[model samples]
Target: MRPRFVLPAAFSVAAILLLVSCNRGDLPGKKQLESEQVQASPVAPVVSSKVVEELPEAAVSPLTVEQRLEDFDYMWKIIEENYPFLEVNKRLYGEDWLANKEEYRNKVAAVKTDDEFFRRMRFVLSGLNNGHTNFLSKEEYPWFLESYIRAGLGSEPWVNVFQQSNVLVRYNQKPLTEQQQSPKESNNNVNSGETGSKTGMTSGNVKKVIIEPDQIAYLGTRSFAGNLMEMDSSEIRDFLIEVKDYKTLILDIRGNGGGNSSYWRNNMVPLLINKPITYNTYSLYRGGDYSEAFMQARRLSEGLLPIANIKDEQMPNIPPEATTMFRNYNKNVDIVTPYQSVGFKGEIYLLVDSSVYSSAEGFAAFAKGTGFAMVVGGKTGGDGLGTDPLVAALPNSGYVFRFSLQMGLNSDGSCNEEVKTVPDVEVDPDTSKPLLDQPAIKKVLELAASQ
Candidate 1:
């Protein structure tokens, strides 16, 4: 079985309705809201406005009052059962989503068209304030259902949760890339001056000595979402040989929103080390559809549910009501690095920023958990730990959506989603400078040169 990794979300209300970004979409970089501003702000957007391309509109019909209410209640029930962030929302943002059930019902009841129903779902889902929690687009519903099955979630019931009464007429996966760039431009090098690998985005300009900072081998990417077809392994392979003798290796994933974790496990870790590193991580989730389905999907290999210890210290700061609603989950992932002679053995420094999220956030967590690297930079966008986003569909209308089903907990017992990944050497990203020239990279490079 593939190593169990819990899932990956974005939308402020408008961004989601416009289908601005997707759970598995190729959105580049966006900073998360400051803690002081989360409550009033829209959830951090998933796709970059620079690359916004709309999905084809569904030839959808409006639901009747009965149908609308049924869809509303079904959507609410999905959240109530599987969503893991209810208390986190209440505690962090002062948004009491649990109390707004009827209000959401009224909004759903008030929607007059399929478009209106879609927007209403977006509004309700965005209220959770998690980038990973939102409704799936008509185009993405089938995509997510495929993901759910691929994730090994129990197939019998939830797979049959609702029939696709409205199959999206013209869902094209390549549209975003195509719209963003013509065939001529799409394969061009990332703005970074290096040009060998189009499959992965590592650029050689990352190594240029800037000012006083020492020249460091920079293997950077804005995303790890690159494993659709075989990645040109030669990029990482040949780059490793090029930088093998450098004192420090900079794994710069500054604006990355994460994709395939396998990229790191198969490529980065194995090339760097001769030993295995076991990462013990924890999550908090309800014993509902997602949790239970995943539980069945990957049993005892992870651990049993409803841990006996009732200590408040083990749980993150949330209302007593939430603790009552959820149970603890834990897993130990062993990354066995397969080292080769030309593989990089230098000190690895992970460069990150607030835009580092999802699986990128997982890199930070893994670095911290297993001593894979010294993390340097700002706090990352959270929601890194836990399983893949859980799949759901409204029973009445076959309207599909997904949301986070678990809260990633840090070693210190703080919530990863709330605390984020705090760098060992923290530096706020200065937007005025080029991303690679950020203070953290400069500081760490100077430190790397000295050592």
Candidate 2:
């Protein structure tokens, strides 16, 4: 069963089974009565709707007083009992549920339609001011991902990677190739808009680059929340199989807000080595209430395995569909220590900035603390540790309670539980353009050249 319980944006929930024997002594048809009673309970309505180009104009609903109260009661009950983050809700709303509830009732009454209701709900969710506390429904998740992670076609020729003071800027368009023309000749061609064998290069931001036709690669990872999980390194083995061309790899994690580290550890790590490397043992905390629904689902899943009566058969495993819901369900599981110690000898330069937080900071800290890579850039965003707690809704209002139950720790056993990971190469930026501008790029290039 796709777990009906949700973790919202910033939190992560549980289990139980109850069996009660109904007193059917007086009933003539006991089985039939029991069946009827079982069917009486209601299933929550599914919220699924395609995005409209624009929200419909507000229209007054003809709901009666009783109907409005019923809807209000329904929303309130859902919030109070079902919201995963309890601490957040409790802090925002008070112990006196009735007074706060009445306020929501008035707000709900003022709403003319369902659209207004959800809009208010969104506002209430945003009140937590926590980045992870999103109130998006199932459909909204995919829509948000599609909007954020964009894919482009064709080779961007003029890839200018530079920094504007501190922010990084990646310009599209090939800086005239060696065989093509000199700097002056290319400048003239730009004035005339005439270059031989023109490639349809469009203006775009730089994602990654290999600079100076030499042994240095500069990568600009803006956020860790990209589709790194879906990528398999074997698919791109030919690309990084031999770093013979580039002796030094400058991985610009500058503004990369961390995402799923599993993707980085599993897929990206292998590319660094031509041979296999195993991760050493690391300890992580596990709470007893680490999602019972997930555990139950996992049990049911094993029984339906393809290979019957063969426990040892090495069958290709498929990841659970509900993995995302359990993404933040538990505390630390293991610290990835190299088993064989075949480290990536190529000098690595990690670029970072203030925007890097949570998982991004964790990765940077882990890399530096574990002697993986040297960190560069400005002071980090200072959000290192992450707590994926359950959110419980207020009894009457849209307020949600969020709190952390488990903590993530670095490899050295020092939990970045409260502090941010400071960078090794701390270069202050010019405070003019936004951080994601040319300044970051220039710094990375200059840093690589110096090394």
Candidate 3:
């Protein structure tokens, strides 16, 4: 049971979906209901006979009302069933999503063009207020779809519509079919094509500096996306060798929006720590079409999430699925760290800010909870807990959308997204400077030196 929060008066979409729900009609019986309920086609969704060679052509000629209806219904159904944050959003933001289904469906009905349709869909999803649950931006759509292909969703029939993409390929400056590079291996900037992880956002590149000549050193990177360590293997290797015996190290992640967790887990963590650091946490999944298909497509097993058996009282206000996953977690989803040949015997401090999010936030969570590091700086951007996002395609346009499948919970049962990691020692960052050069980072260094 969820706590009753006073809802804000701005809700437009509700939970009762008239378009998605089946109509029982004047006579209510099993035979009549079976005939009236829409069934998924064995071959393909009902689409036009004409092939859309260029996506822009399809854009110019907006999909018919009925076709758009199918797409809208597809997205809504997926959200209704699999999205874990609906209740969470209502509790935190006072937007009751379940109370406005008819309004959302009407907005979909009023869409005249695909661009407008996309923006409107964005409008609808934004109501959820989750950094992970919202729809992708126009620039982010194609790259996300290409990513799904690697996850084995390419076999989907609607995915073929993306193969012929023209204008959609603008972000990476490469055709979707040709851009099969892995997130860690490929250059997606920050897993997108435009602004780079280490290159974009005016955030300083991945670099190591010896502030007090090896006694105190600092290393900062913008994203865990892309192969940062591998890209600078020799330099990083030499830096680690020089600094492993250092007294104190400051690991700064201020502007990192996130990418792959493995970038830090396997690449970053072990090189500094002497022994494994086990971080116990929960991973939540709302079993449904997208979750089921994603599970199968990725060739994963449900048993992967160890049963938690956590008490409802332990977890405060959060999504039920999050608690359910926690209580049923088979094993702790710990960030089991490995011992390194070159380890830092000195005290390590992690520097973070609101910009540090997603996988970056996960790192903050792990460090704060496991005593892996003395976490300092500002509060994180949150939404860091969870598995990779789940993918879905609008039937008419094959426009792919994604949201989180798993909810991340801290060891104490607080939702990672809601109860973001708070710095043990709060130091205000001088916003005018880069991450390493920030006065707050300097203050932390001073504190470490004093100790």
| TM-scores of the models, in the order given | 0.72, 0.46, 0.72
Candidate 3 lDDT, tens digit per residue, 1-451?
1111111111111100011000011112323212323121111111121111123422234578787778778888888777777767777789888688889878778877665666566666667666555444444444344433433332243244344443344212334444444433443333333333243333234778888886888887766653343454345545777888888878887766666555566556667665544455665666665566555443333465433444543656445655452323322444353534465677778888877777788788878887778888888877676556665657666566666665667877777777788988788844577645777777877787687
Residue 222 miss distance in model 3 (angstroms): 0.7
Q: Candidate 2, after superposition: displacement of residue 325 in Å?
A: 22
Cα RMSD, model 2: 20.3
Residue 405 of model 3 has an lDDT of 65
Better of 2 and 3 by lDDT: 3
Provide the global lDDT of candidate 1 against the true structure. Answer: 0.56
* Angstrom error at residue 32, model 3: 45
Writing each residue's lDDT as its tens digit, candidate 1 over 1-451 gives 1121211121111111101123322321122221222222222323212222345554445578798788788778878877877877887789999799888888778767666666666677777877676655534443343333322333333344323333322222323234564322322221222334653553332332223223467776655543221243456667677667676777877776765555455556566664544444566667775456544543422454564453534645433543587765543334343545364556778887877777677778777666778888888887776545655666656566667766666666667777788887787655458745678767876778677
CA-only RMSD, every prediction: 9.3, 20.3, 13.4
lDDT value for model 2: 0.37
Model 1, C-alpha of 331: deviation from truth (Å): 3.6
Give the candidate number with the greatest lDDT: 3
lDDT against the true structure, per candidate, is 0.56, 0.37, 0.57
